[model samples]
Target: MSGSPPRRGSALAADRAEPRAVRTRERVVRALFDALAAAPLEELTVARLCRDAGVHRVTFYGHWPDIRTLAADVFAEEVDRLARVPEDVISEAAGPAELAAAYERALRDQLREILERRDVYRTLFASGSDAGFRRRLLAAQQERAEAAVTQLARAGAEVPGRASAYPAAFIAGGVVAAFEAWAVGGATGVEAAARAITAQLPGWWPR
Candidate 1:
């Protein structure tokens, strides 16, 4: 933030190269996107991300606790955008099936967007072997899921449970599982994958 050179950590050496600290961060994130596209997450490392972003190690550490966290932040915009559908919007639809269909449509639109940019999510998710990495990804998803469920309840959708947390957890779990499997090279068909999870909504959530 301070144009002052980054502290001498591996996260930021490359960032110091640039006069502006903000510019340095952008460079690092850009490099990460580039690297993950070409390889798997197992191959990605903090050193590599710093080098690719053209920043120093200090710069990276300054910005993220780990590469996985950074990757999640990179993909955060898309996730936030997709999760923006008003919660109550579900009730406008006639029934659970209609609501499920509508929800899936919105979800699919975003899922496709993420899938289309498969390299980033794939690479970030590929790092799922690490608990911290998976937690970061899952936490971000859970936040969005919770908010969406609240919105749905406000709109009049009957989430089976009296509270939002249960349904929210169930929905987030299903979606995250599907995406996680795909990231790890699971054989499930995309349509089938989406439907498999979406189909559960009619029964799993409040009808």
Candidate 2:
């Protein structure tokens, strides 16, 4: 015999609730960014966030444990958005030198964007910022770097007789640290920061 029919009423209620949940999330994110524009994350409180978002404290707690968690979610989204390089530029590289140049260009572009929002990032990524946020941010960047390096290795990029993970980790860790330092130093000189990063890549890398 067939199983009993699904609960249509419950399913319908969930379906309707999803959009409202999404809207609430959007409002919270908007409020967080707006607040950050005027004040640092350290100064932001759950009460103020809920007030600005027009959400209740219970509603805010329903989504995140505290302000730092919500801030992490917001900054994570920004990091991912700024970290993505133009795929077409990478794909169209005619040789290793071109590919390296493309990578530098992409890095500079990303840095420029970050420099535009320097105050916000400087506060969020500073030494005094949330440790969990920094860890998650570094992990996300490392994961992306690992995947890219792995793909390059599969496509004939050199790795100095070691596995791709070695270079991936080195580059990811160095770049993240370099950028974090740059942010902590008042987020100046995008060109200098980008150059410092590109200079660290080993000769065996795609360059």
| Residue range 1-207, candidate 1, lDDT tens digits | 679854533343335455686687678768876886787655789888887777777656776767666666667555656755555565476654455566666677666766666666666666555424455556767777786666556556666673647766776677777676665563435676666666666454533
Q: Where does candidate 2 have its weakest 10-residue lDDT segment? A: 7-16
List CA RMSD, all candidates.
5.9, 6.7
Q: Against the true structure, what is each candidate's TM-score?
A: 0.66, 0.77
What's model 1's lDDT at 122? 68
RMSD of 2: 6.7
**lDDT assessment of candidate 1:** 0.64
Q: What Cα-based lDDT does every candidate model obtain?
A: 0.64, 0.69
Using lDDT as the measure, which candidate wins?
Answer: 2
Please name the candidate that would achieve the greatest TM-score relative to the true structure: 2
Tens-digit lDDT string for candidate 2 (18-130) = 78767877888899989978987779898998899998877676667677767666675677566665777667757556666665776787677567766666666763444
